[model samples]
Target: MRRIRRMLVPAFAMALVFPAVLPAQAAPIRATVKSIEFEGMAAPASVKEMADQYSTASLKVTYSDGSVKTFPLSYNRLFKTTDSIGGTVAGVAIDHKGAPIIDNSVPANPTPYVSDSPDSNSLFQVPGMAPSALGGNALSLVTHYEYITFDNANQSAYGLIPASMSLTTLDQNKQTGELKPTELNKIDFSGVNGLWIPCNGSLSPWNTHLGSEEYDPDARAYEADPKATFISPFVQAYYQDKTKTGNPYDYGYIVEVKANADKSTQVAKHYSMGRFSHELTKIAPDGKTALFGDDGGNTMLFLYVADKAQDLSSGTLYAAKWVQKSAANGGSADLQWIKLGHGTDAELKVLVDKGLRFSDIFETSDKAAEGFTAIKTYPSGKIEYLKVKPGMEKAAAFLESRRYGAMLGATSEFNKMEGVTINEKDRKAYVAMSYVEKAMEKDAKGADPADDIQVDKISSGVTYELDLAGGAKDRDGSAIDSAYVPTFMSGLVVGEDLAKADALGNKAAVDKVANPDNLSYSESLRTLFIGEDSGMHVNNYLWAYNVDTHKLSRIMSVPAGAEATGLQFVEDLNGFSYIMSNFQHPGDELLLPDPLKIEVLAEINKSFENRKAGGVGYISGLPSMKQIVEAAPVIGDDNPTDKSLVDLRAKAAAAGAKLEWHGKNKDIVVTLGKHSLTTRVDSSTATIDGKKVNLPAATQFSKGKTYFSAAIWDQFIKL
Candidate 1:
């Protein structure tokens, strides 16, 4: 008989309606005339746009108050190199002072070509330079992070853009027999292996940038040539026992960088937090608890509780287990947290120092039969045990966390769990799952046989909200209970017939959202911003969803072959908000239209050829909250004299509040937070929290939507 797992949906009634039913021809959401628009700023041009048609002028933003401001947004090309502080090319030459020399006159040597060599021009070429083993074109690619600072004294804003140097190699000049050094771009951070494929990151409460290293140290490549001295020492030392298999274990961890512009930035790799294909980290309001999402199939969601507030160097790591309580795909589940153990770097290093191999912690078949203690039972009914070998437990738990978690009964069954955002006020976290693959769907079904799991065949993506409130807590208010119910928000879906087109044309059946990968929430805007990283859209977009109004709007989009990433909202001292985002790998051939007319393809390819500078970083301004409210649509009956009450009901629903209408008493009551507001129709006053407060407009009602002044609506809701 097959074992059945039980599933549950937490807070099922409050689930947001999925946008899958939206019409394909729905108009793009836009701001009305009352909202401010940035003039002279041209909309993003498609690959088909002519070179001359591109706009290069600074964006002129016109605020609702008629104040005009200009933001000079442009790409910063400076990045650190071994010989220089700044350079345009991947390889740079420095002057005597160690500053980058912007000289293009160096004679190009064509003889004895080293460009094809994977190990050429690496950092190892020069002794005493930054120690890095990365090689090839990986060294040339520079990923950047943008930092903004506001000065209250001058009422001005400043920006700091630092580029993370990709992997590098040492190349020998055959003609001169001299070694060429390929250095890193940003080096203010000390004691860290250079970043490779620096993916999405978050700003910590201590005001620092935490970047993730995605897909590092190809194990097979290292195994193919184990004698290479350029291999990272961490990889070489950590996997000494597994060198034959080439399973290097040093890569895939979070790197923290200081965000202070006034001081030199410091960098540290939090290896104790566990290594995996890290997507991003969202720290809770308490500053000690953090939620980490991994970006790969069969991965796991990790939780870390720091030893102290605002410090991530030491922590306890745990893997999540989803106890099925319901059958709905992307629905809620009773979350169980399985402890994988904890330790500081100093404590864990003792085990590493003891020469314990990573594979030693696992009980072999021969050893398992010898009666080792069982750690946990796997889904396949296999029993895992802690190896009897001394000093192996802590090392394996820290170095191979995913495996250790599995031994401890934690589920590692997620499919590309990407970005995560936290709402401090609500104590909820929204996690983005890029796709519901076949295996995850299977796990959901097999987890519970009592209910049927409804999973879409052509899965797009989903955003799940995990409730962190009212859980079993410890002394410090950290949740010790593993049971958490997550509400699912289906923002993108693909139908069967349109699946092929959606894949080839990179278009979604409904344009509201597709393949959401990165998310950020702004309390001031009362909106959640979603950035797409997918091939299911012709041009990936950054959408803003007003949680209060339940309105979705496309605020920005990228060119073909590009996905919007690294979304951050920064408010200046003057109360103006700007969105900082990056466009990764644009103008790729794969982004072209499939089965298009030959002429159209020719035109598009020609345009793309001339504009193939793929990646770019941008900072765009936003409209004020009043402007957004003014742009919102108002509904009422056609009757001229019929007064309408503002649709407080809709607002209540969006805010997750309760609304009570007293028809006979001609009054409406709204309950939110610890306060209750009661008002009568055609009244200019309302009682809030049992105290009379002035209302912006008289309450009115109509056959259609209830109508009220925007001022009154703002007063009643947090928005």
Candidate 2:
């Protein structure tokens, strides 16, 4: 075989490829990055958690040519400010007059009270996001921010939101996919009685931000008296209706904000999806199916199926029934969904406008009585017994959803199930069991009617994965309308609970996820980004877990006492990829012991303006191939490829293709890959291997040099 191969190549062509006499050089193989990997960030020691913690971010970039290289990666914080919407820091907050709202009420600690930024940004899949009217890169966006006043001296925050969900266009460097906030304008929520406490949100399949309102006001309170103190916030600050009426039905639903090219937005609170303390709403890979976990205790796993794709205005809501499979590892369950009811958002708005009370849908009693069916349910995980009124099942399903779900025997064992995300390639979904305690553990933390989930109370928490399938049925054995439904769920990543506190007063293992809250999964990278909202750790961390490798790496540590929030991993935004992260309410972890808080509070407070702002930022090292490529070609882009060997020789070296002297006839051989060209330096024609080809220009012999004008120079690339 060796002799046979040696005979194939004109032996002369192998030697003197780049002689000392020639200025041109024979090319060697080039290396380009093919993959990247990182190591976990170190846990902060003691008070170091009070400051931002970045891991020793080292990158392993593997190239296509099988070469390897390493580099140090760093976090490029986009912005972190308590500054009001007059500038671009985070998502802005605007008021009724469409001007930035400067809520400097708390003179000691002042910052923009920015809520949830969507999981996906405006730069994502820009071609699909581009409005047909604005077919190019140019587009406009307006923003509105809802704000709360933090009275730091009093150690309490004002709960009332002056405005609702803010909408704004992000300024992005189209080439790099860098997002910068600009201006903000309030989205008038008078149609929905003003937006509630807009919390962590997700980006919809149709490019909309699906936001949440944590801790819905108790409808029963409003049922007893329409002038409840909780109702005053909206009436006084938002509606300004001195009449003093707040409709409980109007708040606590999934809010969608759709941006348009004209800088206008269409916003709606989807009542059909059921009202609960929504943590975050994640749309399934199938687009129409939506899944979310209620943020409070004794809650139920919720799923919403839209009648049409990319439409959330109307849908059928379902609650999960947990059939326990194990009592270990955060527990496993075969999930059976119970169909609740269906309705249109528009229709629900009509009912909300009518000011429907809880009493209108169900009759309640302190104890079990005639015609009153008692069921262990909620005032948020504790227990409330109620009966459904006749002919109000549908209304009860939407307006008083959790109550109706409990009455129907849905698993009310889930407590503080925070974020839901999916890995499309594996057909699996993940839910963050922020705290593996209370209702999830049998009789633990005094959770009653503990029928299902029974696991050890691990304060460090666990992230669970659900096996998804296309065809699914409810507890009644009725067909579910959509694909993307979870059939079974098991713990994917569980944190370690320590019996004693660490040096940093950490109750959970420092290297593991403590009170895992915000989660974002990148399908392309096969990684799940987990954020912490814990009292277990002195400082919350953001972690990256690779599904294939089963490697967990701590990528970042937010300020002490701050909740790691706004976690979004974008696989591709134009030409780059980014791991988005944010922290809120720094120096506000009331969960820690007073002593620990006292030690760290002052330092964490100093991290921001008067120590108020939690940050809004992202990791910056990851970039796609398109992002890393050169602006110009790797070879001769300035001169046409159809040039003489003299002109092509210079580019040949850059392209990593060989230029060789061949044969006794003074022919030259240019080899790129498997193909090569052979021609006399003084001939006007050439032969690609053995095929004859004509040259556009005649070859010439200059002083001490030979040139061949071959239009076929470009053909070498194609070959």
Candidate 3:
């Protein structure tokens, strides 16, 4: 085995190559901070005082070759009062005649509101609305899903930003911190409201961005009067006619957005996937199977199989059941998929069009008993049960997916299913379970002790890998026997000691990952990037774990109050692979800040507090896979031999070049601009525009695939 000495270079270096041998055991890769850069104007004191305004920062990487590049970052502008649309920044008021009036006027060019409280003072005031119902004034922005077009003619990258409307502020008494009942404002994005709590999303195989709308209006209220349900008086006034006819049913679904080259967007919501507090949605390689994770207590893992590939408008949704194989916590479980029923978006839309409310599906009196409705015995010694009532309308099943799953007997014991990422090559999906509490005691009551399969202990979170290719048949004609194992478990906090944290959060440690949230994997690097959304860490950090080496390195730390999210691997046209991420909502004090010595704090106060300045921004930078594994003399069998070419193809695409191979000529050709390089396999000699040149490492064929050496990349490719 050869050892590679990795050296850190300056921030502007184009590349940094490690000496580790490829396909062989290599030394652990360590992260070195090259440089931190800031963009956009400094947030105003008013914005800084607010809990929502987190600063957006972009990271620049200097590769081993000294080529420096930065990932592009952008923010969405808020809907202003002066906008021509009838949408109002302030809340709406109902007149004496029972008509809603929107106050769309800008208040004498009012300055941004400053407040002592961490919540923003900006208000969307509705005169006739109750103050308790006024929502916060900040534009809701949360996740970013990057869509890359692979077309050579129109290669582009578009970032789809979804506003997660999780929190809103009604009027509050400044001195007493009490809710003000008279004046209230309902927050609305543009003129369109009701996009509450957009959560993590995925880029579909068709290149569309799918954003999940998490959380819903008060379920009880909606169930009572779905036609006139209002989360707040302000929301009631703002929604007006929509709420009058049961519009709450229209909000909690998955939205699909397609970005145009001009930076414009076309958006639509996929109601057929079912309405729930969706944390993540991943489309499998087949493009027909979509796995969804619900982010809440007593949630169900959903599977949606589209009627057509690349089309999610219509689908059959199913709830998952975990048949416990072991009683131990975080142990393996055999997954059973139970069909929750199916409906097309158009079919479901008819119900909404006909003023059907969520309450129309199931009886409100039965809400407390909404789990595992029917039990069926199978001949194969397997028993199946319906989590939800069987006779509910399919439209209702789509509208109230969580409830439907529950009534169909799906396991609702999983807590906070955060992120889902699929490995195309392995045909497996990785799901992050933010936390697992002991099985539902309510469901366990009066049930057979042997039949209860829920674990007995609590866990911070565990990443479970589901085998996509394997499954068995259940009596209901559904697939069972899908095996899942815990791959990563969050570190535990004990005795208030943060420094003693361990990988599984079973022990305390200062640098350990607490709550693992957003996840992304790099095939070329064989590494998984995990982002922290935990309060255990003073400053949530982003980490990278090598799948092969089992090594985890903390790469970046978010400022105070922000969680690390939107972890993505993007290949630019220049052949560089960059990690794009964001620090969401800093300065809110979700967790205790790292203890700072008085002297150090005083000294830092003289400059500025990075943590105190909160605003959303992009952070990108990381070495390419080829550079990390170039040092070893011999490649190992575990590493793919064609890894270099795979990376080269990404680089060439980024660089506006075409990379292809001519089997007849046994040559690899890369054309960029007016220059071209043609290297023949097994030949040290090559031709650059027909001029003969000696190659450093001859291209070799292994396992029926051509493998290009790092020397070819370093010597021939300009990048």
Candidate closest to the true structure, highest TM-score: 2
- Per-residue CA lDDT of candidate 2, range 634-666, in tens? 222223446555555654676688987756667
Which structure among the candidates has the greatest lDDT? 2
User: Which is the better candidate, 2 or 3, if ranked by TM-score?
Assistant: 2
lDDT of 3 by residue, 520-550 (tens): 7665455566666665554555555555444
Candidate 2: RMSD over Cα atoms? 11.6
TM-score of each: 0.58, 0.77, 0.57
- What lDDT does each candidate get? 0.47, 0.65, 0.46
In candidate 2, clashing pairs total 12
**Relative to the unseen true structure, what is the C-alpha lDDT of residue 10 in candidate 1, on a scale of 0 to 100?**
12
Looking at candidate 3, the ten consecutive residues that score lowest on lDDT are 1-10
Ranking by TM-score: 2, 1, 3
